[model samples]
Structures are given as structure tokens and as C-alpha cells.
Target chain A: MTEVKKTYKHYVDGKFVRSESGKVYAIDLKNEKYEIPLTSKKDLRDAVTSSKAGFTKWNSLTMYNKSQILYRLSEMIEGNKESYIILLQDHGLRKNEAKNDIENSINTIIWYAGLVDKWEQLTGNLNPVAGEYFNISHQEPIGVTFTLNSNSISLDDLVKSFLPALTVGCSVINFSEKNAVIALKLSEDINNSDFPAGSLNIIAGKFENIVEDVGGHVEIKHAAIYDDISKESKTIIGEKGSESVKRISFQPPTSGLSSILPFIETKTVWHPKGK
Target chain B: MNNWEYAESIESEKIVKIEKKYGHFINGEFVSPNSKKYLDTISPSSEEVLSSISIGNEKDVDFAVNAAKEGLKQWSKTSPSERSKYLFKLARLIQERSREFAVLESLDGGKPIKESRDFDLPQVAQNFFYYAGWADKIDLAWGSEISKPYGVVGQIIPWNFPLLMLSWKVAPALATGNTVVLKPAETTPLTALLFAELCDEVGLPKGVFNLITGDGTTGSELVNHKDIKKIAFTGSTSVGKYIQKSLAGRDVGLTLELGGKAANIVYNDAALDEAVEGVVNGIFFNQGHVCCAGSRLLVQEDIHDIFISKLEKRMQTLRVGNPLDKNTDIGAINSKDQLDKITNLVNEGVSDGGELFQIECELPKNGFWFKPSLFTGVQANYKIATEEIFGPVLTTLTFRTPDEAVEIANNTEYGLSAGIWTEKGSKILWTADRLDAGVIWANTFNKFDPASPFGGYKESGFGREGGRHGLLSYIKASS
Candidate 1:
């Protein structure tokens, strides 16, 4: 008896389907290459639509519950550590660095998971002036972020940039780096975890052509690019992202491996104990 | 007589004596250093030794930090109103004795008398006055319910704008209740020393502000000092990187205002007359010694030919002889080393197949000076376009669309500041959003205010230096 092979499609809107555009890109992981399917523009629209629907309910959830879900995702990544290491190694990382990268990715998720309940305390509190009836301030998630991962650290950098946005309840549309086979594998791992379908979507294509379109999209509230390029590239990215006044962050030339725990805003809500 | 011969006569007329002995300012007094090593402060314009300053070795840094540590206790405890009063008094006193400060700064630092009087001395006083207002009203500036100071800040300022840079550092820090141990650049230490004297005259508490004179080693000693809670530096990006590396494992707060290769974009629809002025001010201001100066000009292809011709014609009319002259439009290069770097980069641009556009004006022979230069038909990868010349040299490139202009503008590691000139209001806003620079000028150039936030992005360095955002360098978010 002969066994039948199975192929997976993009997991979007709680279902897996072939790209509507019928586009598939081959992932080049060093000497070995495999066909990894990507989400089309139509698929992306569907994911964003689902994410918008889920956001209201997800944002209103208690911080504790949100934290619990993030922690579960971290645990799931930990369980798939061996597979992740293989994926990273295939993307040109040395054995030890690959292990470290995987560990760091998990640690990043866990760090932001803990910050879910404490953003308000870190950002600040509002003063109640003499005549004001009520005064309060809190940092809400900026909304859907379009992230461009660096080619250098395909999997780890993506995780590091994405987790913080997610911890704050912002959905992400990540543009994986060219030849990022490991990142696609990691995306599959995330899909298998309890994260709602369309909460995180991955796309692969020509960077220059696609960057402007993604940046100009009105649905994207913010964008971050991690590539090292000329000042001209930065300006184009800025201008493209300006269509929607997207909060743009360009990673400096220094290593992006530093812990971002300090930057995360923690909201701490306090009420009268006597109540 | 030729300008060179005239400059020589003027140089000979100023027969100033160079002093050899100096001391460190610790605990509100000048004290003889434990280590006797010294750095020679030379006049960039004449290459003459103006003074030999005692370099602050590690021991001196320790002494200064200890003094600041003690100063922080009482100084931070004082009411903001009291601090404001003290600063206001100091500002007035400095103004009253402006001549002495200007003369000393020009003699030691080789800046023109006009700049000393008009820019350095006045801006320093203005900084104190501006920050003085914030001292008592800081609660309004901080969005948070409570604000706290980071004690014992270590500051290192550059040579270009000695007194002004010092005020930029010390005013906000002191206003926010942080005691400072500041190290003036090796070549320019007199103005800061004079400031220390003024601090005493104003009855600022002992140890509230300490002055240390030194080069990079001394700055490193102070930055690495154990008692220092924060570091504020303004200089080259290379040094900024070193400081970042040194403070990697530690929790020390840092604010770096470093190098820039900023862009100035001109559209075909721009007001050509206003843009001509912007181009001149962009690269020629302060002899191009400013870190945020727009060193690159990206003109629209439609106007490139006409704009370059008009710009060069305007450059030729600029007076470049003497910085002390009230009519001098461009001053001498800050230092001989800086002059050499500029000429070398200009020569590289020519060698790389770009055309040079000199002003056709003569330069003084004795002092370190270079006529304003422009290079057109240069590629983005050209060394002159990519590297920071830090002198009155400008590079020109052409772009077709707004997007292309933005593409050219943001193509550098330094994102300090940029200029946009167009008649349309919407275009100005559109161009500004695309420029990666921190400060975007619309239809104007080099206009600065105490109310406006100013800083750089990427390798131009982290942190801001003006307005409410500037106060963040002195405050601790923790408490």
C-alpha cells in the first residue's frame, strides 16, 4: 500500500485555502528548497477583516486572560523547540545560535505576556484638575501593524518584533524576509497554537514593490522595517507609510537582539478597596 | 590689499599670550589636579596655542563625581522656584559681562567675534532664561503625575558651539534638579571655565555644577564613573557608538546628539527665491559646523539646471573673509583638521567624476577657511554625498517626483534634520511626512526655538535636545 502526501495552505479566517491569486513561492533554505504557500492580497483582506471582527471582544478581555493565552503560546513554542531549531539552521544560523534564537523568541513572548496588566503604570497616570469631573489616561494598542522582517535573522527578529505588538492586542501582517523558510515554518507553528486565525498573517514577495503597497494601506495603523539600506530607502518607506499617518519605526544599525521589556507599557488598574 | 595679506595683519595685531597652568572645578572651586597631565588648546583659525588645560584623569573625574553627588542632595531638595531665580540671576550677570566671555571664547576657540557676540554668548544666556521658566513650571511639562531627577549626570560637549552647547546641557539638567559634572572639549574649555566662575558669583550651591577639562580619555573616565547616574554627549557618531558599547551591560541613562548628513529637498514648484535663501542657510550657517545642517540638496529634475545656477551665483556674493566682520556671511572653518577633511571630501567628489561649483571668491591664507562649495551630478554612493563633511560643502542631486525626492532625502544613516520648499501647503505636509529626519522645515531653513523639539534619528544619535522632550534626559521615569 502506498501512502498519500498532504499539502497545507494558508490558515486564514479559521480555514486553510489556496491563495486566490494562485501564487506560490519556493522557500530556499540553503541547499534544500521547498514550496511554501503564501497569502494573496485577497487572503490578506480576509485576514484583516477577521482580525477587525475579533479585536473588540479580544481587547475587552481581562489582562489576566490575555496573558494566559500568550503564556500558552510560549509553552507551545517551547514544546516545538527541536523543530524550530531545524528551521533556524536551515535559514543559515549556526547550531548554538539557532538554539539561542529559539530560546530568545520564547523569552520575548513571555516577557510581553507579563506586561499585559501593567501598561498604565509604566506609561503614566492623568492628573485630576480642580474642576474636572473625571480624568484618566491609558495606552491602547495602536492597531494592525505591518512588519518587515530583516533578512539576517528571519525567525528570531520577526518573533521579537511581532510579540510586543500582539501582547498589546494589535494584530500583525508580517512581511517575511526573502528566503525565510524557517520563518514560514515558525508561522505554521503559530497557526497550530491557540492564536485566533488571522491574528497573525505572513506574506512573501518582492520587497520594493510590495513595501509601498503595504505601507500605503489604510488598515495598517503602524509599520516597522528592520532592513539596513540607504537613506533614500528610508525616505520612500516613510513617504509610503505617510498616506495613513502610520506610526513608523526604523530599527537602527545596532543589533536588534536587545531585550525590549523596558519599552513595553504596563497598565495597572486600581480601584477603591472599600468598594 | 588682498584678503590674505589683510587677514595676516589682523592675526599679528591680536598678540594674545597662551597660558600653561589650569585646574579642575570641583565643589564650586578650582582645585589643583592630582594628575598633572594637560591638553593644549589651540586656535583653529591660527593654529596658535591659546592655553594648556589640565586634563581630568580618572582621579579628577572621581573628585568631580563625588562633588556632584554631594551637590545633588541639597540642589534636588531646593524648590524649583528657587532654582529658577538662581538661573535668572546668572543669565543677567552673564549678559552684563558678555564682552569678556565673547573675547575669551574667540581667543581660545577661533570663532569670529560676531558669532561670539551674536550666537554663542546670546544663545547661552537665552538657554538659561528659557530653561529658568521651566524650572518652576516643570510640573506642567511632564505629562506624568510625578517627575524625579536622575542624580549626578555626566555630560561631554563638543567644540563647535562651546557655550551654547554647554547651556543646552547644563540648563535643562540643573532645572530638573540633576547635578552635573561637565567636560568641555579639549580645544575649547575657556567659556565653560568662565561659566563655572559665574556659577559661583550667582551663589549656586557648592558641588551643584563641576567643570572638568579634557580630551576623549577624560570624557571616558567621567562616562565610566561609578557614581554617574546618566550620560549626555554631543559629538561624532563613532564616539557615540563607543559610549553605547561601554554602557551595554549597565543601566546608565544616555542621550547622544551626534553626527549628521542631512538633506535639503527643492521641488520645481518651490518658491525659488526663498529656496535660494534656504540653500545658503542650510550649508553655510555656522560655517557648516552644525550637526543638523542640511549638507545634501536634492532638487527636482525640472528645476535642477536653473536652481544650481542661481545657487552658485548667490554663493559667489557671500562674504567669506573674516568672521569678526559684521558683514561676513560665512566664517572660517572651525579647525584646521576640519578644514582638511572638507577639502579632501570635495576633492574626492571631483575625483569620483562629479563637477565642482566653487563660489569664485578668494579665501584668507592665514586662518583655516574654505569657500563654500557645491557638487552636482553626483551619485548617491559618492563619498561627498554619503559622508559628513562638517564644513561649508554641499552636494546636489536631482529627483523627478515627490517620492523620488523623499527616497533621496532619507538615504543616509543620519536622520538629523531636513528642509522642504514648495509653494503648496499640502505638498509641504506631504514632503515632511516622507522625510525620515527628526526636524522638518517647511519653506524655511535653520529656524530654531526653545518651544520646538529638536533631535536626530538613527546614527545621527538618539534623544532630543530642545523643548519639553529635551527635559527627558534629566528626569528618571522610575520615580
Candidate 2:
């Protein structure tokens, strides 16, 4: 009997779809019987558009609801832990290491889910701006984030980049190259869960093809990238994103809330409440 | 154009006493610079040299840093109450001599006397008074006693809002028990020099507050000084990036309140009269040299025509003339270079097919002057819409929905401030929630208080410079 090879599509907007350019490449992992979409610049543009559309709906969700959806997504990931661990093993990880990665990934989601409601009180303030006006400031999501990270990143590190942004109500167009299948499987779990469509998009392809377009996209408020890119690439990102002043940060070993805080902008609203 | 002209209401320039030449203020007194080079500080309104200021070089900066390092030893050991008392005395003295400072600010910075008197002077005094009380009570600033002041801060201020920016940087650093080596912007060093006099009157500890006078070279020396513990700068974004790069591998703390091209979104449901007023104040204030100036006007498409018409009519009524005039709404541009930059950008807007509108008024011929102007029909990618022109040039773009308004508003590299004008409460909250800016003014614009922390997101720069949050940049956690 001959085994059937499955072709994975880029998960964008709300559904899995083939690249607009009809480009595909065989997976680099050993013993994998699948190929992933080599997403095009147009596909990346479509993902940004979808992520922008998703931002309104996802950001409009109450913190409680977002927390609930995030919790559900984490549970789905945990439920599919065995499959994810097998995929990680096939992608050149020891079984124990793969299990740890899966566990840490799930834990990261849960950690950020718990922070969804508590972030406001922790950072927000009814500032004592000396005047006759009542001034209050709170953190708000920074719309769509375009993340270009290293393919060598662990699943835990990859998800860490998106979790804080997601918890703050931002939609993410996350790009990965080497771990394409794992990113695709995680997207499937997100799609099946209560997570809103376009809230999280996973694109797998050649990094060179879509980087400039994604970095320069006007709609993307945040861009998280690995520091491994050339100085010329950083300069290009700086020049392209100069107009709207995109908040681009090279990932540090440990981001925690520091990564999340930069992506969350403060909004102080004043009203005439004083007599 | 409105045919309403009033007699000149010039505030007397006799109130300010300009010295023939000035030296760097180090330790407790003015001293000659190690380098003999001097630059004449010129008044933009008259094109006359107000004074010759010593051009501080690398050695001058080193002298000031050494003074601050010595000052920090006793300053850090001083009782918090004593520091608070010193600030209180300084605030009172500033209030007493504010008229002199206002006249000097108008003469040196080319801002209208009315604004210098009514807005700048009061705010300068207020900043001192507000931060004065914080000196003795900094224990309550953070959650625990873990916060400790970073010693010997290097402060570099800008030409716009010269004295007020100094107060903002100086007050918080002192309140948090840190000595300062400040370099005032070259074009407007007189007010800072006068401020040094006030410091002496208050008997602030010798070497506690040192002032260096020079151009960008002097600023570079101060920033790169090895002994300087932290850097606080307010200037152009390009310079802010240079500072960031310079301090990348160093352990020095840094804070920047840089450039901004803010968005003022006026919805169809907004009160048109109030909205128009807000738009004018947001952009035209300080001749639009403000870092948080609402340079981009995003009017909802439904009421775009009416708002633009009303705004134009309002622009016509603005009196542009001598900075010393009591009724002047606009003044001379800060310098010849800044004037050229504004002219180039405005001409670019015209070439790009943007509808240019300017107040029909004759400007003074001998001075650096650019008419208060605006561009309508501006696309998002237009140079006028994207860059910080840093003059009284506003770019108007229309949008149909709140979402589109937000899209246009957030499409800039600078995010220091934004203004949302709508009568609907929920809509204000909704729009404000979506806007990516550090300060969002709903139904109001260009409103500032020393107690309100102000800074920027993204390229607008980082670190808050007012309120309790402002103290964070001056101190670090003990852990």
C-alpha cells in the first residue's frame, strides 16, 4: 500500500488556504511525508488585512471573554499534546525535550490568559493630573503585530512572542520557516477553539520573500524579529516602518511582560468631572 | 481675510536684561570655557545678536560632569525635606521673576508674549511647585523602598519650550535626589542662564545644578561623558536614535521626549465649533514646534468640508506678528534653518497636489517667518502628512468611519499624542482605545499639566517626563 502525502496550507484570515502564487516546498524535517506552502508577498499582505479585520472583533471582546477563549485554546493544545510532541520529535527533538516544549508552550498560554484581566489594574491609573479634569489612563492593544522570528526557536519561545500580544487584544501574523508543520498544527488547534478568526495567523515560507512587505505594512503596529538578521535588513525595516513608527524589537532571551508592555500603548482620556 | 486690525500691543522688552556675553554655568558660578570658541545667540524676531555664549566643547562638558559628580556626593546625603525646601524656594522665586523670564523667552525663542506670559511661565512655575512636594515623599513613589536615584544625570533640552523643558528635567531629578549637568539649546540659552541665577538665589547646593551652553557638539560631549549616570533628552527623532545607539552597550539609563506627528481625529458627531478650536490649538500652539503637536487632522468625511471651512476662517483671525505683541497668535520661526525646513515641506505639499491654505498676513521682512499654513486633500503618504514639519503646518486627511480614522491616525512613525473630538462618550472611549499614542486628549487638545506624565510610543521616543511616573527614569530598583 502507498502512503498519501499531505500538503499543508498557510493558515490566514480564518481558514487554511493555498498560497496565491501556488508555491510549495517539501518539509526539511526527517521522515515527514508532507509539504508546506511557501507563502508569497501577496499572501503576507492578505494575512495583514485579515489580521486587521480580526483586530476589531477580537479586541472588542471583553477581557473575561478573551481570557475564556485563551483558556480554551490552551486546553485544546493540551488535548493534542501527544500529536504535537510526535511532530516535535520528527522535527529533530528528543522525546523528553519535545514533551517539555509542549508543556512549556501550554503553560505560557495559560500564564498570559490569567494576565488578561489583571493587566489593567497593574498598569492602568486614574492619574492625578493637576487640574479640574478627571484624567484616567489605561493600556490598550496595539492592533495587528507582524512577527518574523528565527526558525530555530523552540515552540515555547515562538508562542511566547504571540501570547502577550494576544492577551493584550492584538492580532498576530506570525511567520516561521523551519517549523512550518508545527506552526500549521498549532493554527489548526487555534482555529478549532473559540479563538476569533484572524486573531492569530500562521504563515510558513521563505523569509526573504515576505520580510520587506510585512515590515513595511502600515497596518502592523508591532514587529517582533530575531536579531540574527543583517544590519542592512534592520535598516530596511527601519526605513519602511518609519512613517507610522512601527514598534519593532529584537527578541531577548527573556521577554516576559517587557515584550508585552512595549506592544501596549497608553490612552489617557480626560473629562470635565470637577465642579 | 478678516479686516480687523488692532494697534500694536507690544509687551515692553525692557523687562529682560540681556548680557553682552555669557559663560558656562558650572558648580556655583559662570566660568570661561576651556575652549575659547563662542557663538552669538541671535533673536529670530529681529535678526540681531542677543548675546555671545561660550561654545562648550568636550572639555567644558567634562568640567560640568566633574562638578555634578562632586555635587552628587552631598546632594545624595542631604535630607529629603531640605531638598523639598530648596525646590519650594526656587518655585517661589520663579513665580516672582516670571515676567522677566517670559519676556526673555519671547525674545529668545520667538514665541508670542501672550503665550510666554499666560502659558509658558505659569507652567514652568507649576512644574517646580508640583515636583517640590515629591522630594520628601519619594518613598511613596514606588511600592517599596527598592527605588534608588541614579546619580549625576545628563540633561539636554531643545529650542522649543526651553525653560519649561528644563524645569521638567531638572525638577524630577532633584526631587529624586540626583545632581544634573544640563546643556540648554543654543538658540534659547538665555532663559536657562537666567534659571541658573534663580538656582543661586535659592542657594541650591554648589555643583547640584550645572548648565553648559553650546550647540550639538556640546550636547554630544555631555551625552558621551563616561561619568554621566543617565541621559534625558528632548529633541529630533534622528538625534534620539543616535543617542540610543550611543548608549546601547553602556549601563547608562536614558529617556527621550522626541518628535511627533500626532493625529487630531474629528468625527461627524463632534461639536464643530469646539472641534475646530481644538484643532487650531493642537497644531498652532508653540508655532507647532511641540513634540506632541497634533499636526495631522483626521476629519470624518461626512463633515470634512464644513470643518475645513471653519478651521480656515479661524486661521484668518489669528494675528501673526512680533512675539512681544500681546495680541499676536503666531511669531517668527525659531531659526533660518528651521524656517527653510518648513518652507521646503510646505512647498512639497503644494507640489504633491495638496490644497494649501495660509493666513493672509504680511510677515516681518528682517526675521525668520513662515505664515501659519495648512494642507487639505493630503494623502497618508504625502511628505506633509508623514514628516514632523515642526511649524504651523497642518495636514488634513478625511476618513469615513471610526476604524478608518484610527487606521490613518496610527499610520505614522510618531505616537506622542492624539486628539479625539466627538460628543458621544462610548465612541470617544472606543476610538481612544484603538489609537496608538502615549497621550490621548478627548474633546480637548494641547492641554498639559506637570502632574500628568507625557512621552511617546514607537519612534516618538520613550520614558515619561512628568508626574510620579516621571521619577522612574531618574531611579532604578535595588534588586
Candidate 3:
């Protein structure tokens, strides 16, 4: 019996679809070769549209619901651990290394799941303004984020790219390059988890192809790149992003309170206290 | 009909001592510009040249940056508690000489002495005092790793709040262990120069707080300097974008507090009389020179007629005249250019088919001025509605529902500040939650405190300017 060779399309708006340009790049691995849909400028635009509506849907849900939904991703991944290990194994990881990667990914998910309802408490505070007023400084999600994942070919590394933004109620368009195999594989579990349709769209393409579109797109509130790109690319992103005063973070922290700080806009509310 | 007049109670300028000419304050001393050029700084109220200040060229800016780099060495060596002591001393000195600073502020910046003395001066002192305590407690504010300074900082402030903006920029930069090279707005450099003297009086380490007075070219030089680790700017959105573009590909930190077109939403349930006062203060404060001014009034459709009538009546009573006059509610426009910009925008509003209503008032002859303006019958797409006029002009838009109100309020690209007026608690929460603005003032407008964080969302620019969050602007996480 022969095994079925798989073709990976971009996971967008909870649906597996090919790019509008119909272009696909190949990833040659130790055991198998997979073709990923190469996201174009038009594809990036579409992802932004979906992520905009998806942000409303995902963010409207209570933090408690968001927390459980994030926890469900861990459950789905835990149930399908062997398949992810196999996918990693195919991507040239040793069996034990694959298992450790999967474990770390699940732990990251659980940590963020528990964090969804609590990050506000850690980040925000009731400002003791020197006045007879009730003033509090809190935060809001910068909607429709585009997170460029690092080129490191590990599920945990890929997971870290989108989790910080996602946990804080921002809709993330997680773009992957060579690690699309791991990201696309993780998308299956993400789909099974109860996420709003476009909240976490996993699209695969070379970042250079869509860097300008990502920066120039006004609807995409933030463009955070975890990957170490060239100075030229950084300049292009910064220059284009400045047109809309777009928020762009380069090589942001991926594991701590600082990780999600880039994706939030602090909102301070003031009201006079009186009878 | 009632004929009313406000008696002028002039605030004496006897306390302040303005020099005939000024030089760049670098390395804790006033030095002549290597450029060998000076621009006359004028009083917009009287059209008198207050003083001649150096127009800093690249060489002058370079000298200041080098001095800041040298200052950084001593600043880094100073103990956190000792740094706190210096800030505390500065804060006390500001309070002691605040009246002089306030009078000079009105003389140069053309804001009413009422605001300068009572609001700006007090806030400036409070800001220094607030950040003074935060110097040693930086480790407790965020983790120690996040409290590391970005070394030499270049700060450019606007003309509206000269010394107050200095406190906003300098206090935290020094508190976080970063040396500063500051550029005050060309039109308003007197108060900042006076502040430089205070820095010397406190015996603050040289280069720790450098003041270079010049035009935009000086600011451009500071932004492009390779040794500057961070750039903090407070000004128009266009300039902020230009700065951001110039810093591209560089490993420098930036925090821009820019322009805004804030919405002051007046729900039907709001107390009508109080709401009118709030709406007036929202737009008319500081001649609407505030970056966070509530320039757009979003009134509920049911209360539109009554609200406008009340607002117009209230606006008419506002006294407009000399900045030194304690009774003046509005002062001269910051500059002739700013006055022209306001006049042109108001004219455009009328031609755009918006109904314009300006208060009948006697403006002083020799000064730049604009009457408090209100535009009704305004479409959301009108240039006056969409653009930041940055004057004592308010555009009114009508909304039928809470959802529509929020939609209309968040429609603009700017999200700097907003005002929500409703007697109901839930409605205020619902509206504040929906608005995209960085600062939401419920039942009050134009309120400021050092402990309250302020900035903007969207194109209004990024990073906060006050409170615990303000320290973040000057520091970087070690990770």
C-alpha cells in the first residue's frame, strides 16, 4: 500500500485554500516534500479583510470563553500529538526531539490559555491620579495583527509567533516561510479548536513577497516580525508603515509579559467622583 | 438681550527676567551657536520680539549630542536615589519660581495667564515631582530588566506647552538614566531656556539635560544623529511621520505624541448645562492647541438643537484678549502662521456648506487671534471635520444611536483623546469601551495628571507620556 502525499494550502478564515495567484513553493524534507501556497500581495489583502471581521468576532467573546477556547487547542493538540510528532519527524527532527517540541508547544498553549483572562491584571492598574477622580489605565487589542514567524523549524517557535497576540484578543495573520510544514500541521489542531473563523489565519509565503503589502495595509493595525530580516526590508517596512502610523515591532519578546505589550494600546479612562 | 463685558485684571510680568539674547544650553552652560545665526522670538500677543535665540545648525546639534553622550557617562554613574534627589530639588525650584515661569510662558507662548499659572505651571511641577519618586522605585514599577535606559535621548516638544512638555520629556529621561538633548519649539523657547537655568541651579550633571533652541532643521539634525538612542517628539502628525520615516532602518527608539481629532460625545441623557460647559472646555481649552483636544462634538440627534443653542451662548461669554489678563478665557494664536492656518480652515468649512457660528468678540489689534468657532450641518467627510484644525474651532455631527455614535466617533484616523458625557454609568462604560481613543474623559474634559497615562491610538501616534507607563517611553526591556 502506498501512502498519500499531502499538499498544504494556506489556512485562512478557518478554510484551507490556495492563494489567488495559484503559486506554491516546495519544502523538501527528510521523508516527504510538501508544497505550500505562496501568499501574494492580493492574498495578504484578503487575509487582512478576514482578520478585521475575525477580530470583532474573536474579541467580542468573553475572556473566560477565550481562555477555554485556547485551552481546547491544547486538548486537540494533546489528542493529536503522535501526528504532529510524525510531521516533525518528516521535517527532519529526531523522534525524541519531535516529542519535546510538541510538549513545549502544548505547555506554551496552556500558559497562554491561563493568561488570557489575567494579562490585564498584570499589565493594567487603577491610576492613583492626584485628584478627586476615578482614573484607571487599561489596554485594548490592536486589531488585525500580522506576525511573521521566525524561520526556526520548530512547532514551539512557530506557536510563539501568534500566541502572544492571540492570547490578548488580537486577530493574528501568522505568516510562515520554510516552517510552513509545522505551522500548516498545527493549523489542523487550530481549526479543530473553537476559534473564530479568521482570528488565527496561517498563511505560507516568503515574507519578501508581501512585506510592502503588510506595511502599507492600513487595516492591519500592527506588523510584528519575529524573523530576522535584512536592513533593506526593515527600511521598507518602516517607511511604508509610517504612512498610516502603523505599529511595527522588530524581533519582539516571545515568552514574557513584554511579548504581548507591543500588540496592545493602553487606554486610560477618567471620571469625576462625586455624589 | 444682555450686553456683558469682562474687566481686564492683568497679571504682572515683573517677576520674570528675560534676556535680550539667548544661546544653546549644552554641557550645563549657555554657549553661542557655532552657526552664528539667531532668530527673533516674538510675543504673539503684542507682536513684539521677546528675544533673539540661536538658530542651531548641524554643528550646534552635534555639539549638544556629544555633550549628552558625555553627560550619559555621569548620569549612568549617579545613584538612583541621588537622581531622585536632583529631580525633587528641580520640582521644588519649579514650584518656587512657578509664577515667574508662568508669566514668561504667557509672554512667549500666548496662552492665557489663567491657564499658564494655574494649570500648566502646577502640572509641570507635579510631573517633575511624580517622576522624582519613580526614579528609585523604577525596579518596582516594572521588573529591573525593563528599566534600563536607552542612553542618549533627543526630545522635541511643541509650542503649546513649553515647560510642561519639558517636564514630560526630561523628568523621565533623567529618572530612567538617559541623558537628553532637547529642542524647544521655535515660537516658544523662552520658558524652556528659563528651565535650563533651573537645571543648572539644581546642579544636575552636565549633558544630562541639554537645550538647543532652533527651527525644524535643528530637530531634523537631532533625529538623524547616529549617537542618539531615542527620539521623543510631541507635535503635528505630519512631522511625526517625517521623523518616523527618517529613523527607518536605524536601531533607535521613538515615542510620538502627535495630532488628534477627538470626539466629545454628548448623549441625550447628559445634563444639558454641564455638557455645554464640557463641550466648550473640550475644544476651546488652550485655543484648541492641545493634541488631545476634543475637536469634534458628536451630539445625540434628539438633543442637537438645544445643545447647539446652549453651546453658542456659552461660547459667546468666553473672554478673548491679552494672555497677561487673568480674566481672559482665550488668548492670542500661538503665531501669525497658526492664526492664518485657523482662518483658512474656518473659511474652508463655510465653503464646504457647513453652517458656521463664531462668537462676537473684540480681538486685540496687534495680535493674532481667532474667535471661538462652531460648525453645524457638518458632513463627516468635510475637510474641517476630518482634518485637525488645531484651533478654537468645533465641528458638530449628529448621531441617532449609541452604536452610530461610537461608529462616528471612531471613524477618524486619530484616536488621541475623547470625551463621553452621560449621566448613566453603563452608557459611559459602553461608549468608552467602544471608542478607540487613548484617553477617555467621562463627564470632564481636558483634565491632566502626571499619574494618568496619555498618548494616542492610530495615526495620532504611539507610546504614552504620563504615569507608570511614561517611564516605558524612556526605557527598554533588557530582553
DockQ of all predictions against the true structure, Cα-based: 0.04, 0.21, 0.83
Per model, state how many residue pairs clash.
14, 6, 0
Interface RMSD of 3: 0.6
TM-score (C-alpha) between model 1 and the true structure: 0.68
Tell me the TM-score of each prediction against the true structure: 0.68, 0.78, 0.98
Winner on lDDT (1 vs 2): 2
- Clashing residue pairs in candidate 3 (N, C-alpha, C atoms within 3 angstroms): none
Please, what are the lDDT tens digits per residue for candidate 1 over residues A98-211? 899888878877777787776545544442312211222233465566666776664557676666666667777666646445555566667666666666666655456455
Give lDDT per model, in order: 0.72, 0.85, 0.93
The TM-score leader among the candidates is: 3
Q: How much DockQ does model 3 earn?
A: 0.83
Which regions of candidate 2 fall more than 4 Å away from where they truly are? A1-60, A69-112, A142-166, A170-263, A272-275, B1-5, B79-81, B136-139, B301-305, B377-381
CAPRI quality band, candidate 1? incorrect
Give me the iRMSD of candidate 1, please. 15.7
Which candidate leads in DockQ?
Answer: 3
Output the number of the lDDT-best candidate: 3
Q: Candidate 3 regions off by >4 Å? A: A1-4, B1-6
